[model samples]
Target: MIQRIQSVFLALGAITSFGLFGTDAAETEVPVAGSEVFADAQYDVYDSLILTGGVLAAGLLLLIAIFLFTNRKLQVVLCNVALMITLAYAVYGGVLWYTDSAAAQAQVDFGALLPVLTMLFAALAARYVRKDEKLVRSADRLR
Candidate 1:
């Protein structure tokens, strides 16, 4: 189920990066409302989307490793750390927006959600592992 969710997210990210979401590119001269109309370039969008996909893929790979190894504590710690960083990224973007900077506007996109999703799944994997461990420990104590 989790794998399926991750796959779906991956596909979504791919579709978004490929301009399925919008037809604006970073390098293209796009027309805005009340402004000159032109096709927009997607360089920045694609770059950010690619980066996000790469990071999410990395986290998924890590989750797979944890699943195979059942390393409860390690997975939990990793998930927590990833969540923190994800939060940081989110906050940073928010701050940039609050400052009313064009750069901040540039950073807004679906790619920003990748770390957050990865963190969530990693944490879920960790919880499963810890629950399995607790069951094992309980059995051992009964013995």
Candidate 2:
């Protein structure tokens, strides 16, 4: 269970994705009643439904895949799906920054790539899952 390397990878993925909440892609000042308040780019996550959904989905998939260890192939597939979602999330943020102009007053932060770490972990977990599946198949053949 917890001893499995794949499980560890999946857990790390979940942690990193959720941890995005604590890290700011970028920081800016918000004015309220003539007072300036510091804020993080994370506020953008709530503004963009697609980005929010992708982040939540990617974390959820990694967590859910952990329990499906018995179904190694399916677990691998789910991790891959999570990987794709994370990739899209990162690219969407990148594109947003690239296309944005100074007139738009939007902050550009490569820190959005934080989710990419989760994607990397998911990919690693998928590789391990596939390895486990192959091992099982080989064992079955010998039996």
Candidate 3:
């Protein structure tokens, strides 16, 4: 379980997903009326229920996949699902940032890359799970 490389990758994916809560996704500057000043607003995963729940779900799925080491097929499936969800949430976050009226000078933050990292980890885990499955099959054939 924990000894497997796939499990480590899955754990990393989960950690990255959960890390979203600790960082800001975007920072926007709202211009003041007739002034050369702007107020800064930071957006994070907690700002939207969808973003919060999506990250939570993706993290949980990766964690669950890590424990499903005995069932490589299921673990791969879970990783794929988590990757898809992470991609979706990332795109949604980008869309939100693009559409924000006060985001005239929006700056993307580190949290915005968490989803991409999670997706990469999930994909790597799935690939390794498949490799392990193939290795088991080859070993069984040799017996």
Task: For each candidate, give its TM-score against the true structure.
Answer: 0.49, 0.80, 0.89
Report the error of model 3 at residue 46, Å. Answer: 1.3
Give per-model CA RMSD.
Answer: 7.3, 4.2, 3.7
Higher-ranked by lDDT: 1 or 2: 2
Q: How does model 2 fare in lDDT?
A: 0.74
lDDT of 1 by residue, 4-116 (tens): 33334333333332322243222233322321111122323233443344444444445444444445566556555545544554454344334432332233445445445
Tens digits of per-residue lDDT for model 3 on 1-143?
66999999999999999999998877766543432212336778876788888999999999999888899999999999999999888888777766666556767788778888999999999999999999999999999
User: Rank by TM-score, descending?
Assistant: 3, 2, 1
Model 3 bad stretches (over 4 Å): 29-40
Top candidate, metric lDDT? 3
Better of 2 and 3 by TM-score: 3
lDDT of 2 by residue, 37-107 (tens): 12232334553577778888988999999999888888999999999998988787656544543213444
Give the TM-score (vs. native) of candidate 3.
Answer: 0.89
